[model samples]
Target: MTLLESIKEPQDLRTLSPPEVGELAAEIRTFLVRAVTRTGGHLGPNLGVVELTIALHRVFDSPVDHILWDTGHQSYVHKLLTGRQDFSGLRGKGGLSGYPSRAESAHDVIENSHASTVLGWADGLAKADEVLGRRRHLVAVIGDGALTGGMAWEALNNIAAAGNRPLIIVVNDNERSYAPTIGGLAEHLATLRTTDGYERFLTWGKGVLQQTPVIGQPLYGSLHGAKKGFKDTFAPQGMFEDLGLKYLGPVDGHDTAAVESALHRAKRFHGPVLVHCITEKGRGCLPALADDADRFHTVGRMNPLTCEPLVVPAAASWTSVFGDEMAEIGAERPDVVAITAAMLQPVGLTRFAEEFPDRIWDVGIAEQHAAVSAAGLATGGLHPVVAVYATFLNRAFDQVLMDVALHGCGVTFVLDRAGVTGVDGPSHNGVWDMSVLQVVPGLRIAAPRDADRLREELREAVDVDDAPTVIRFPKEPVGEPIPAVGTIGGMDVLHRAPDPDVLLVAVGALAPLCLQTADLLAGAGIRCTVVDPRWVKPLDEQLPVLAAQHGLVAVVEDNSRAGGVGWAVGQALRDAGVDVPLRSFGVPERFLAHAGRGDVLAEIGLTPVEIAGRVSAVLERRAAAGERIRPKENGA
Candidate 1:
């Protein structure tokens, strides 16, 4: 059998000879390249961690000894080692998730795809183990770049305050995160970059001291201690040491023996120990290494024959629309600026960066910092658009609420991937933005139904000066437009029957699906009226008024069913005492696993056929209760 086929678990790896283990690393790398290339998933991050993964699995007993991968993107190699070699369906509809999934394996301790969160998890797990009197070791493998996040420091502080637990905080210093890690940590690491190499030179300097005479032994010992002190004084990581955790390494991460050796030493230490292992980001992949930015962070599906990446659609994505319009907005108004939390290209701010280099800022995975800084910019009488991924924005909720909204700063928060995002898995899904952002005081939230509205709303968001405003959109390109049949307040009536039995209120991208449902219901002689509420939050004042005229009002949204636009509309009708019965159609209030966007939507009963059937059933129930169908206020 092949090397990969011979292994079914981590125990199988421990049995292999060192040479065989090295060969197995090679095999794993090859498998990852081919598998991820075919699936269009994270490739470079996994390629860089093959040997590190081998060392981790070999040294620690996982499932018993917890292994937490901070960002989870680099855990692809971990998945391969943990007996999950089924890449045939990786990141597809029912395939293996791109990130770690607890449902997939017990070895994965946390489903963390967000950056700078592993350290905090390690601290908590280690503490819990202590409280439960469990002997299992808690190990958190965090990227060096992730240290730039403020949350990591908070975790580090707590870890230090808790003193030594059998927690191994491995800093996988890959020298990069998307774009060469920014801020103070990067500079400190740069100092160690030369200092580590100079250790060999320190050995040469030891020779010089040895030649100094009979007193050289004691003198050399004292001088060696002095040299270490000197290094620490100049490049002091006293921040970690002061917290009471043992600091180890600056070791070569590519050397499996060195990594394994350091881990073994850390296991013996009584307190929390940080083992800093330096490795390359795209170690085995030449093409990825040569790429100047992000090292091909995440890839997309491509044409098999032409070898061309498949475009989402011809019309620009909501992200690109925001990017293109923001560029013009920035040019037109000198006060306008753009910000992203280490997601410059993914959020489509690359062109914005290029056009307005002075106005754009990449905050290095610190979403909290990005949000507060945008608030500061707003306070200074400048317009700051904080464009971040829908999921990552969760990290900065407090900052958005307190610093931006509570303070009443006019910061424009643009969320890309505001609904279900496929392939990247549950941790990366943008489903909770609307639900989470609802509590922010004086925040105006808008959802664009198509590309044109995305452009216009983004412009309006930047221009709005009363309070903080958020404009969110999905991952895919804006498809076909749903032209309004009529306009009332912020809601646009897309399809209205002269005598309406049901009202279909579509929020954002769900308008097209609403139109399809209307067509289906028309065939069934249900006479449905569909409206797109462009602005979801201050909920189109006319929605309750419109709901009062119908027997049944069905609200369709792509967000969580609880606390979504649909729920808001229902509450509005309740407050107004409209008495018209309503039904809400949206994603369920549960974590969704990795699946295609359409597949996920259908499963949640958000599809056109499902919505139509559901609406018809509700209308039938209302009719059974003796409610009569009503005519439109403005006759359709």
Candidate 2:
């Protein structure tokens, strides 16, 4: 067996020789490229951290040391070292999670996949350790990309204030999060990366000043007193040092010995220490290294040799449709600008960026900054469209409510993965946007059912000169257009029965499922009229009237059942004095595991067959009660 196969636990790495450790690194990279190509996960991030992870495992005792990973996508190598190397069914139902899971192992902590949260976790853990008088070391492995977040800085400030606290913060500077990291932090890191000569000169100067005559000792003390200014004049390593933390190397992250040495030194230090390790995002695997876009950061199943996707391409996704339309919109409106939270291409702003370079801004992995900045942009007489994944929008809820909605700024939020993003697991699924954004007063949310509506609603959202507007769509392909046969107060009447018994309210991409359920109901002699509420938030004024004519009103959506469109519709009916019994069909209010979207939806009873069966049961019960059916009303 090879060095990798021989190792089952992190302790086993301690037995390996220098040459064997190097061999293990090679074997791990080769295994990652093959296994990840088949399983489809965070390949580039893991590949980048092979040597760094190996060094961490070799240097620290893990469970005892409390090593935490920020944005746990880079923890695959950590997983492998901790004896969870089985790659089959990765990110599938009942399989290994894509991110760190506390349930998976004792070694795993902080399962949250959101970026820039590890520092806070480390601070808390370190504080607890100190309070309890535990000798365990607290090591937080963070990325340079994650440092852009305000939370990371907040944690850093707290960590710095506790001067006697033992905390080792290893900054894995790979220079990218989803895309290349942006903002002032990236530029600051870039300066740190290039100032090696200055660092060397400063070290020599410090030693020389300390070794000189009586005047030299006093001069050295004076320089140490004003170290921040001295470093600023010479090396500028004062960023972390000024924060009352010990600063270590710009160590080559790929060199195992160098990284291990730096980590060892930090561990020995009895106070807060920052170890800056420079590494490439896609260090190994030529194809990943060659990838200009995102460095193959995250990928689907692909050929290991060619790095080309093995699966067949589906129809254009909702993101591409929005992207194309945004580019067109940008060409027409000079004041139309775009903002992204470090995801330019993924959210479909690449074309828009290319067309209007100066108009587009990448705010790093800081969603809070992105939302607040969009508010500023809107205030500056520009209609700012912030494009980001639906799940990530949860991070900026306060900013969205206070900065955008409160000010009534015309900031359009385009949420790409709006519902049930299955493979990436619980933290990634975009099922909470509708439920969470419901309480934001004056905020209009549009759930586009198809590509055409996505294009149309996007234009409509931007046209709103006051109040925040959100246009959200799912992760799946934008399938065949489901054209509306009629319109009633901005609602699309997809399928209308002459004498309707049930009013099927379809929210966004759930239109197809709603239509299928309607057909099943029709087959069972239950006449159903299906309507797609394009704008789910601020329910159409005519919805209660339309539902009042039907015997039952069933609302179906892909978001959480609690506080979703169904709940909102039910409230509308109750307020309007419509006594129609309502049933809601949606995802359960629980964390959904990793699986295909269809499988998860089916499991949660969001499928047509399940919905149809429930509706049929409800109708049967109503008939048994001998309730009189209401006649259909024509006017909206």
Candidate 3:
């Protein structure tokens, strides 16, 4: 068996000699490229942390001693070190998750994919350890890109204050989060960040002291204490030291011996210590290193040799549709600008940024700052479009509501990946945007069914110069445009039977599924009509009137059923005094597991067959109840 295969647990790493550790690191990188390329995952980040992970396992005892990986993508290497060698089904149904999972192993403390959260988790775990009088060590591995977030600093502040806590914070400074890190971490930390001086000094001291007599040990300890003056010369590690946590090194992350030495020093410290290790993303992988660093950060299934995608997307993505239109809008309207939370390329703002460099702001991974800054831009007479992932927007809900909506700032929030994104698991899914944003007064929401509607609705959202407007779309490819045979208010009527028994209200990407459900209902002797309500919030006045025309109403959405657009439609019908029986079809209130989009949707019973059957059952129940149906019976 190979060196990597021999490492079934963290303890197995201690068995490797110095040369064997180097061999194992190479084997792990080679295995990652082949396995991850076939399955598709965070390739670049994992490649960068090979030696760092091997060193971490050898230094710390995980599960007993808590070790947390920030932004969970970094945990893949940690996963490999801890007995999960199967990469055949990574991020697929009944397979391993892309991020860390509590269910997957005892070592995975933080499961959420959201960046900059590991530090907070570590802080809480450390506090618990101190309170319980346990002497377990807590190690939180955070990226430099994640440091740009406010939460990281907040946790750091708390961690720094606890000088008695035994914690090791390993900052894997690959100098990236998604893209090259923005803001001012490297400038102030210039001297210490890129050098091996500290590590070299430690190595020299250890070698000489162990070879010498009893006096050599005292001499080394005195030299170590006095070495603080040398580090203070240029504030090399002054940034972390000023925070009260003991700072260790800017060690070469690729050098297993150097990283292990630094980690060993940190492990010995009684108080909190921050070990800064410098590494490169996509290290040792030529194809991955040559590719755009961000693209390689998270890849779909692709050829490992040429770094080419295995299956080319037939249609444009929802993000690209928004990006293309934004470029045009930027050219037409000089007042139009954009903002993204460290996701310029992923959110499709690359074209907009290139075209209007002066008009866009690449705010570092701080979603709250992005929202508030957009509000400030709107207040200054510029129509700012805050583009971010749907799940990330949850961080800026307060700012969107208070700073934008309440203040009547014409800020448009373009939420990409706005529905069930199944592969990355529960934390990565963008299924809660519509539900949470529903409560914001004066805010309007639009869920486009196709690229045409996305373009149309994007323009509409930007034109709203009073209240905040949100236009959300899914991560899936933009499929063929479903043309409207008729228009009722701002809604698109896709299908209509001669005498409709049920009015199927489709929200956003679920439009096609609603049409299929209508067809299934028609075959079952139940005539159905399907409509895509372009603007789900402050819904069209004609919606209640149209609902009154049908015997039953069912709203379908890709979001949670409790408070999604479905719930909004139900409230609208109630306000209009239309007493039609209604059933809302959507994702039930629960965290979906890692799987394909189709599998998760089917699991939640959001398919056409399941929806049609439920509607038929509801109709039969209503018929059985006859005129004896009790008043105020909520079909939902």
Q: Write the per-residue lDDT of candidate 3 for residues 431-532, one digit (tens) a residue.
A: 899899999999999999999999999999999989999999999999999999999987899998876778999998899999999889889898888999
Candidates' C-alpha lDDT: 0.83, 0.90, 0.88
Q: What is the TM-score of each predicted model, taking all chains together? A: 0.95, 0.96, 0.94
Residue range 249-315, candidate 2, lDDT tens digits: 7899999999999999998899999999998887778888888788889999999999999986679
Better of 2 and 3 by lDDT: 2
Pairs that collide, model 3: none
Please give the lDDT score at residue 523 for candidate 2.
Answer: 90
lDDT of 1 by residue, 1-636 (tens): 778778888888888988898888888877876677677888777778888888999999988889999889999888888889899998878778888888899998788888888888888878888889888878898987798899898998888887857788998887778777777788887767666645566687789888888888788788787864755765465556767877777888888888899999999988899888888876777667777677767766644333256655677678888888888887899999989877788788888899889999888879999999998999998999998888888888999989998888989999998889877878778888888888777899989998888888888898887689999899887887667878877778889886787888888987888888989999999887788888888887788888877778888887888888778888899999888878889879898878888888878888888888877787677668876655445353
Candidate of highest TM-score: 2
How big is the positional error of residue 151 in model 2, measured in Å on the Cα after superposition? 0.6
Model 2 bad stretches (over 4 Å): 198-230, 629-636
Comparing candidate 1 with candidate 2, which one achieves the higher lDDT? 2
When summed lDDT is taken over every stretch of 10 residues in candidate 1, the lowest stretch is 302-311
